[model samples]
Target: MRRLTAPLPRCALVLGLLLTPVGCAEPEKDKVTIMVPWSGTEFKAFYAVVKDFERDHDIDIEPQVTRALTQQLDAAVAADAEPDLAVLPSVGAIAKYRQAGALSKLDVDTHAYVQPLRGLGMNGKDVYAVPVKADIKSLVWYDARLTARPPGSWSTLRDRSDHWCLGLESGPTSGWPGADWIADILLADEGVGPYTAWASGEGRWDKGPVKAAWTEWGDLVAGARKGAATFNFRAATEKMAKAGCSLSHGALSAMAFDSAQVKTDGYTYVPSSRGALQVSADFVGKFTGNRSADEFIKYLASPRAQRTWVNEPGFALSADNRVTAYDNATQGRIAAMLRSSRYTLCFSAADAMDPDVSAAFYRAVLNYTDGKDLTPLLVALTRVQRELGYTHPGSPPPPGPLCSPPNHP
Candidate 1:
């Protein structure tokens, strides 16, 4: 018989075991292990939700938090020992796993989720994951004291030198930030058609628009060169706030936002202007079809669970429309932008692309920062892009039927 190794304390995290109680008289409730990418405070918040759910139900949840979710999941699937569930990286990944028979189709009411949220992790008839968290990307953080207001154009900001904080620290997944910069600029300059084509691998990286975006980004970095190239994203935002750098771009947590400027998207846009919001998450997928996990998924989609999520610090609102309020004005504004039909809700190109192809693109961008010419990098990445092609032939199936009962949302 398997032995229980850990107590049900709030902080005790056990790694391996058949956690389901055995040798019981009546019947042991289903014990499920859920792996997610959220660690530290995010894990704490997640545990609180699990703890509350456990208190009211007959189930045991072993929450495993790891940043290397993809690697761990891969290893598990290889060894024929995948976890009961996980918040996988993307719906594209979900499709691959679903095809491999590594996951079970979810049986939950998805009517509340919007079309974009439903499209990912879903095939023609089956749903795989439940959206847990999302974010607004391509944000530019400026010091209120350094700049009177957000710049109308990159040109306006470039007019002032030595006022930007930039970082391109090399890591395993380095250069993603650069890709984001180029993609955001491309979306705004060329519109969604080209961005979607390029993201899905139908377009070429060496094309004029792609190269132009890279050049524009390079020009931005060149004008603000001051130990900026090696800043490393870690603590850079805090340092920017303290050093009073006028302009910065990237995701900054609550601590960094304290010293940085905050404003609504009142900045005017030109004719070619564009913005993209990616609503991604450590999406939960029930792989083993454990009843306990299914119960948890239901609770997760409920308004009560969503309300708790919105109140947590450093988190955006759930994709569910019932969760309309935020703990503060910042989340509220970001949610408004995401839900607005006027603005395009573009998923992350890197997240949606094939892993190997995406890695190549990321590496090429990283190399570009070290004085390497962008021409060859684009050429090589474009070659890989052409070979892969999009995840689906055309747009995914319409989720209008699920999102029907419009009055409910």
Candidate 2:
């Protein structure tokens, strides 16, 4: 509950407003709403910051929490009950909203933000979303109790399957870890350009590297871990949390799980040699008739807000590098990665297609546990890709220093 030193006093905000003559009228209320797309521990941690926001700005935040996050947003948009600020996971939706003129452009400078998250929004120039937090999918967290050395390459992860432990239990998004596996392998095997091309619907998933990635993942799942397929991601992760497991590959968001026994030691995080880093952008959801919502978004980008949020609990990482400099080891590491990443890659899980189509990608990988036929899976995915117009739409590759193809050690 540490409070960041308030910038200018509340009186300053009032003083700057020369609406009245002397000490006459009262200051206007800065009431707004925000939607947080997280539950349980993560939600609680983020709420701490929102409460602080309420306190500092003398604002009342109508905080809404829900499980069906994207649906909630869609409904909000459809019903015209848009909130002032929305902290959502859908970059494509943000793109759509920005295109449809539902969001206002951010007025702040965004030089220090990571490239991938920054790329999430914008219809050719009108930047609509500011990246609040991001998760890096290139990390492999290993229990130091099992092995002292961190894994260096994809070959090591495959060759030494005896120590490779994976948790795929994130419910509806459980298969995403599997997707990361495929994406990482391809990036390692090919380069960032190919992965980006495929994700944007330009490249074909049935192609060699893409197919090879699935094969590699299948071989790992079918190998020594006999019950790997049956390991319910939720249960498996719980098992990892309690008894301490070997190694698992996941986003930086999962670093909160590392404790004394399940501590992160030889954990190595690198681009898949292919240079793709999975990322999601933070967008302002249109909530009800709230005029001051844009001000809150500005607050989110404020130095005070950013600094305060990094210290807040839960599994969030600041997109602002300055705020994380004084954080704990894990937080600092994640912040550094976001700041220095060569390419911040984003996947088309939520925005590009219907839930059924998205679920198919997960089911295909989950059900094909015993190295089952993947040709049909790829073919099916190809059809879905075509139906959704997912073929890479040819946006020029990421530019400048951020365009380097990241290589994993």
Candidate 3:
């Protein structure tokens, strides 16, 4: 016969129950990693959106910020250690990665975006990327206290070099500011046909409009090149008052002033009368084919997210037509220009060129700013274009129109 086991005391039973493991722990949240080049306030603005996404979906977002985005990304891809997504400012890089089979197709709806913006990052019918932020580069910022009137023409603007503040240094992208000036000058002086042709690589760089545009920019900023090449672009605007620089040419986002301080700082801007305003966008693309990553990209392209992002302190513009309102009058005016059918929009030429070609272009600008001759530089660029098969006679232009016509969007 077996003896009956003694029952545990109530307190002991309760203690045993408490000590036993249970399934009460919270489940792990899904995670998505994104590589981005943003820092400071720009990153903060972007992170605001990331937090919104995280809260809505119960996912964790890990952002890897770096100034050398291109180099780091290339290495990551080679090692098969790429992030789930990346923010690419260079459309050329998007195309490059897509062609190399490194990018996963995007399923985000882009109907709200305007023409070329909708068309960018498309490899045939497959969408590889979607623009998350946009900026208008065709703007001239000035301290109203110092200037009675903004320059009405390029000639007048060029003649006022003493009042012009410029800084070409920006780490790996040092000469891009100069490139913007040249592209705007080309589009304004030569017209869209030539600008598009040259940008697409069909036109010769050493001849015609491209050379003229380069020369024009050289004349405008060469005098200021002494310290500008090494000077940081962000600091250019801040030192304007003390440096006697009344005029600064760049996107509002590039200014050192915050969005709230724009109107109050006595700084104002005018749209470059340049034929078509130069515009750029930071696009998001998938790399690891993660479902959560796809969701994040979709959220970023959504109208709600776009609206939220533009209202932040970063001064970003949205390509989404649904994003109409802005927190301040300055932003509202810029947004209206972006949506208005009256103004034509052209993608930034350097941002759209082949990565190698773009790198060369940047170097050429910096060298030219240092008093180097422009002819050899143009010849070298033309040779590079030819070798890349962009300058072959009867060669087809890049798939889509480089410059969008007014009202086309």
* Candidate closest to the true structure, highest lDDT: 3
Better candidate by lDDT, 1 or 3:
3
lDDT of 1: 0.64
Candidate ranking under TM-score, highest first, comes to 3, 1, 2
Worst 10 residues of 1 by lDDT: 397-406
Q: Identify the candidate with maximal TM-score.
A: 3
Q: Model 3 off-target regions past 4 Å?
A: 1-22, 252-254, 258-261, 389-399, 406-409
Tell me the whole-model lDDT of each prediction, alpha carbons only: 0.64, 0.58, 0.80
Candidate 2 wrongly placed segments (more than 4 Å): 1-30, 223-235, 241-244, 252-276, 285-289, 341-359, 370-372, 390-409
Q: What is the per-residue lDDT of model 2 for residues 273-353, given as tens digits with 9 covering 90 to 100?
A: 434455444445443445567667777766677666666554466665566553456556655666554544444333333
lDDT of 3 at 186: 87
Clashing pairs in 1: 188-274
TM-score each candidate.
0.80, 0.77, 0.91
Q: How well does candidate 3 match the true structure in TM-score terms?
A: 0.91
How far residue 148's Cα lies from its native spot in candidate 1, in Å, is 2.3
Any runs in candidate 1 off by more than 4 Å, and if so which? Answer: 1-29, 152-157, 160-162, 168-171, 223-234, 251-255, 259-279, 389-409
